[model samples]
Target: MSLTRRSLVEYAAAHFGWRRAYGDTTEIDSLLNEQALTAYTEAADHAALATAKNTDALAVQPGVLDVRGRVLADVLYLEGVLTGARNRGLDPQLIERLDAAVDHGHELTVLLADTVRTTAAVHAAS
Candidate 1:
């Protein structure tokens, strides 16, 4: 249901439990409830950019994931699907969601890193 750049989310899930929520459901929730709307938006945009000459556009790296939790290569399922994606057709909406997940995953990673740095600095100063 989500693409995570780091295992931090898995750690959080284990710590909080899969179904537990620490904040408002709208802002935060169990991974099951996490909306990750930005992921959807980005994947759609990426799909639109996929071309016969540019299968890379549909690629989901280790960093991004489809709703089903499959990586980009798995999304295509068959090798021929990837080879002929431009001619066989790939779903733009699926690509959009994957791209969005990657974008948001990166954003969350940066935010988490900054928070950790700031907290460490404050603790050291104290």
Candidate 2:
């Protein structure tokens, strides 16, 4: 299942405890831009596992969530680092895996934050 803004935000809000208003969206961006790629890749690798059907996508359900949760944790842990990098005049290129449709600039941040909040609200409902 591809991650839609509404779905992902809602999932984050509910499963991740993020609020739609004034949500901690930086965490999610960082996860997508940095941490989650690895887990996403790993999840992809397990996609072919026949026994993984009990989970959402692939691998054992618990294992899939575990990987995703680890990525989320990494996003949380690296908050200070990402900020510091930005403070140091680091305009690091975003990972290529991020949606090309999503801008990676200040303007994009504002838009993305709103989208995240909206999704988070939906996730909360679920």
The estimated TM-scores of all candidates read 0.32, 0.29
Residue by residue across 1-126, what tens digits does model 1's lDDT show?
A: 245643567677788867334466543554434446656767787666654334442232222322224332343444334345445556876455565565565565555455545555655676
Instruction: Tell me the tens digit of each residue's lDDT in model 2 across 93-119.
Output: 632222232223334445544554555
Clashes of each: 7, 4
lDDT of each: 0.49, 0.52
Where model 2 places Cα greater than 4 Å from the true spot, the runs are 1-60, 92-126
Question: Quick one: how many clashes does candidate 2 have?
Answer: 4
> Where does candidate 1 stray beyond 4 Å?
1-89
lDDT leader: 2
* Model 2 weakest 10-residue run by lDDT: 94-103
Q: For model 2, state the Cα shift of residue 21 in Å.
A: 38
lDDT of 2 at 47: 57
